[model samples]
Target: MRRTLLALLLALPLAAQAAAPSALKAEDVPSLLKPPAHGVRVLALWSLDCAYCESNLQALLKLQRAHPREIELIAVATDSVAQQDALAQRLHAAGVDALPARAYAEDTPDRINYLLDPDWGGELPRTLIIRADGKRSGISGQLTPDKLATIAP
Candidate 1:
């Protein structure tokens, strides 16, 4: 009974996730939007230690696949480059259309997050929807395809 209860408890958090965005730094943002960009950018803020970040990444991959022309997804790594390498492999395997990603370090995390989203409230895996005309929307958690589509071009 204890084991079952423990398992349920462990799984509860995952079940409660909503399609939201995590906070990231300014230096990392540019990596998500490299040259030849469409002038429209959707930033996916992910941390190396967050499991939900990885799952959300996969969801982003799926969303991109479902809507190729509508939006451009920038998978920003709010983690380390070492971690992002593995993430890059996963992204490649999943076929997510991502540019070379930039990693963030703890030393500068605060400044960066504050710059990106002043009211971040310390969240991981945040997504920022940037329109060509510079309009923006902030999503704080996991992602749903419909929400993704709506934020997309």
Candidate 2:
């Protein structure tokens, strides 16, 4: 019984980690963009294979730390379902597994990309800043401190 209990304890964390990222669909983008009433939101889109995604995530983490109360940050992974474990590892390494996150559920990513932004062209490391009043702006590529300030400020 003790060994069984120990196994269960060890498995609990794995289960939680496995469940961390929700399956994101095209229909969910609009609601995800809407922050709580009078609250600012930041949405980060990344892919495991993107060269600049890690740095972009670090910038978002810094922004979140600076404005914990004012900004709500969400991360979305555009990787295939087969890369879920790798995606989780990346999120854990970046210390953002605790934040709200979504992973693409479909194999064809263009559908999700179009739902996110028709003009996006499926770029990696896309960052979107939505203000309390529902205004939004986005940039693709690694974010600079100057640009982060504009988003979180």
Candidate 3:
């Protein structure tokens, strides 16, 4: 009975993780995740408050003008709920939809550090590009429109 219960407990989180969401928190950044309809894997991770992040966001917004449904843009914010609310209002005022970005919770020190960084202890303004089949191209600090497009699967 004990072993079975333990096994079931272990399996619970796997079930939750496998629900396969369009967005999942990666440490500090909320990742825009979607399986390629054509078997291509692609993902982007980013934070707010970084100049490079801002440029990246602009490029992404521009890209969305043409391909909003093609790529999933999950802009993860590390700010408090109040701060994120204000930011969301600003985005709404600019006519940017909330679907592109969402607030990521840093619920624990380890998760927060991983989301931010351990090497540089950086926060905000990060992007992770993952390929189809779960192969990753690596994460970037700042990205341009061209650069962002270059990682498309």
Best candidate, lDDT-wise?
2
Tell me the whole-model lDDT of each prediction, alpha carbons only. 0.61, 0.81, 0.49
lDDT minimum window of 10 residues, candidate 3: 16-25
For candidate 3, the C-alpha RMSD (Å) to the true structure equals 12.5
> What stretches of model 2 exceed 4 Å from their correct place?
1-12, 15-19
Sort by TM-score, best first: what order?
Answer: 2, 1, 3
Tens digit per residue, CA lDDT, model 3, 1-153: 999999999997664333222223453243333344543333333443555655666666666555655555555555543355455654444444343455544345346546444443444455544444654444566665567676554
Which 10-residue span in candidate 2 carries the lowest summed lDDT? 32-41
Top candidate by TM-score: 2
Residue-level error in angstroms, candidate 2, position 145: 1.1
Give lDDT: candidate 2, residue 76: 90
Off by over 4 Å in 1: 1-39, 82-99
Off by over 4 Å in 3: 1-48, 93-95, 107-123
- Cα RMSD to native, each candidate? 11.4, 2.8, 12.5
